[model samples]
Target: MTVPDYPRPPFKPQQQSFPGKTDKMDPRPDHGEDSYVGHGLLAGKKALITGGDSGIGAAVAIAFAREGADVAIVHLPTEEKDAQRILELVKKAGVDGVALACDISDPELAAKTVESVAERFGRIDVLVNNAAYQKYYESMEEITLEEWTKHFNTNVHAPFNLVRLALPHMQEGASVINTASVQSKKPSPNILPYAATKGAIANMTVGLAGLLAEKKIRVNAVLPGPIWTPFIPAGMAPEEVETFGEQTPFKRPGQPVELASAYVMLAADTSSYTSGALLTVSGGAATL
Candidate 1:
């Protein structure tokens, strides 16, 4: 049979959703939701995470919850259902979890949400800027003006707004983590706009690290490789989905669970001295 998009040990079968789902996706994401062990590293902290509905954001929420921090999730309407599930998971981990439904593409919505979360939590100690959007094209000819702007708005503009709005409310020990991609390290013909924005995120992380140093705030970026996230099923060729991580040395896509540890480290004082760096988690692919 012809290869299918992102088959685990079998063919694509019939279970598929554009952008996919952790709850509905067969062989659901291995989030290790039940295995996280928090040592109160982030105890009493209040954190805001954008796109906290699924994948890395969801994993980070679970980790942060276990670490004893109340979490606020900022997500779009399409992500509302997953965001609700994430709140439940976070509460189960024993931390306060609130889901805010708003179009992150709107700058005012971001400011208001962060402001309210900061007010309710009394202070914001950690901010995770992890929202993203991607519209792939086979060639430049296939990309439209509207798609180009949408890519920048969601992928870069939203995080930029979050960082700006959340910065003032953050404390001395606050941390800001941005979601970048391995595509930032190299160009992909199939995802020009996505690769461009991810690269911008990487550079922006470094720039913010330097800019926020005087405030004692840290900024960093995570460069994820081919992870089995919903973004793939929703954003790429069907054939590409079938062979998601074949190019990686491991011959398989990395899981979201594998990414939470570093996040925990960076969030806590464990990586206090580290800032403006890129953490690569791409199944052995080297960073740029």
Candidate 2:
């Protein structure tokens, strides 16, 4: 397919870490904090979202809260403003929220993170494994073993640890949402490790859905295309960030709010029969 020339928007504030910042982001991300209407779709439910400090995760946290679910957000220790803002956003929605600072890449900490969520909410009804990392290299030969490990530990293994720990607390009707990337399908030149981990996520989603069927838990994945998130500004050059998502058919980047509906739909009872599915919001990178 011939990729179109997607337009660029006005510049905004951006973060330099994983998940990135929304509050300071230029023309701040549209989180649908005002537009989303809740009909008690998630009344009294609980959700634990890693990387919930900003980007799509922050958007999901707010949307879940609006739908009547109290939420717990786990983010890297240094992701301060984004973490604090998400707390306020959730609280503004009239739902409880907690910002946990942890290194999710740490297996011990990932376990502790899940336990913390279980303790806070009494039980976890939803788990959104949305944290990820990537480092660009000019060529495949430039990739280092340490960099590869970082990608796997951050993207794939952490989610697995969290899910394993969360399982004992989650019962029937529970859902696990893993944030896979468009890289899993559409190849990129400098992101081999990130792409590989994403492919593992796709496989894990299918495998988990099959294994957890008797437990009545649903495991699914969300494939996000180039969204104007912190990952862009932090990982890409200033010029690259300026032109992020320009290759998509949408002609521009998708905002965080654009993904709120999908997360809410997946979390709510509406998708009762949905499982082993991949929800693609890839700016038309591939069809559903």
Candidate 3:
């Protein structure tokens, strides 16, 4: 996969409401529908992924299933259509696939969703806290207290709660992967709240890795740079979307499929020695 093969900047301007749909994307974000081939690295493992309806989470779900893991994906009720499509793809990989409509910002609801996945899978071998919420703001004054709280609730508190709830079902060798971002380190002021949550996520990942080391369960995070996903169109202005990833060294936004291998590696037993690591999959952009 070369830079030219992927969609580049100056793309056709487009926009969508929060949590956009895949079908509406101009180039249609690829979730490794055809490119990814698994090696049974995670055979018989059971995995749960938040926000598995689309974008990076969706790609990871597909990769996990193809690698022979039973997958349970959690999404919002409004994202059921997208969730169904991903579920079908997962099932096609010859593994058990389940989808739960959940608003994980609610701690109680998140706990219940984790319980259902644990019960269905018999145990949770891998937990991917990949769901997130963000909105564009021109200034701190534009950010309401309610919106600020929502960011933490969805991005920070929810992941923490899921980890807490799933811990009982996880055993030694299980993996926890959080979706931090380039913003965690190199934040943009426009989305300060979201950036702050990501910074917290990165910090939490390192702390959790240390805490879980005694339990032998690894904790890590993936820090993705600019990527062509529903989030771009949904969270930014149409003009900004047009030039989406132009600043990257590759001069193009990464496809969701581009991040699948990193998630697979983290979840695989081969990475047993890897923990508390923040793996960055940016298009040659500096996270520090």
In terms of lDDT, which candidate is strongest? 3
lDDT of 3 by residue, 1-288 (tens): 443388787989898999888889998888899888899999999999999999999999999999999999999999999999999999999999999999999888888999999998899999999999989997789999999999999999999999999999999999999999999999989889999999999999999999999999999999999988999999987888999999999888999999999999999999999999999999899767
TM-score, structure 1 vs. true: 0.93
lDDT of 1 by residue, 238-259 (tens): 7777777778887778777778
TM-score of candidate 2 versus the correct structure, residues matched by position: 0.91
Question: Is candidate 1 or 3 superior in lDDT?
Answer: 3
Measured against the true structure, the TM-scores of the candidates, in listed sequence, are 0.93, 0.91, 0.98
What local lDDT does model 3 show for residue 6? Answer: 80
Q: Mark the 10 consecutive residues where model 2 has the least summed lDDT.
A: 1-10
> 279 in model 1: Cα distance from truth in Å?
0.6
lDDT per model vs. reference: 0.82, 0.83, 0.94
Ranking by TM-score: 3, 1, 2
Q: How many steric overlaps are in each model, in order?
A: 5, 3, 0
For candidate 3, the clash count comes to 0
Candidate 2: residue 232 lDDT (0-100):
75
Give every collision pair in model 1. Answer: 5-241, 5-242, 6-241, 6-242, 19-234
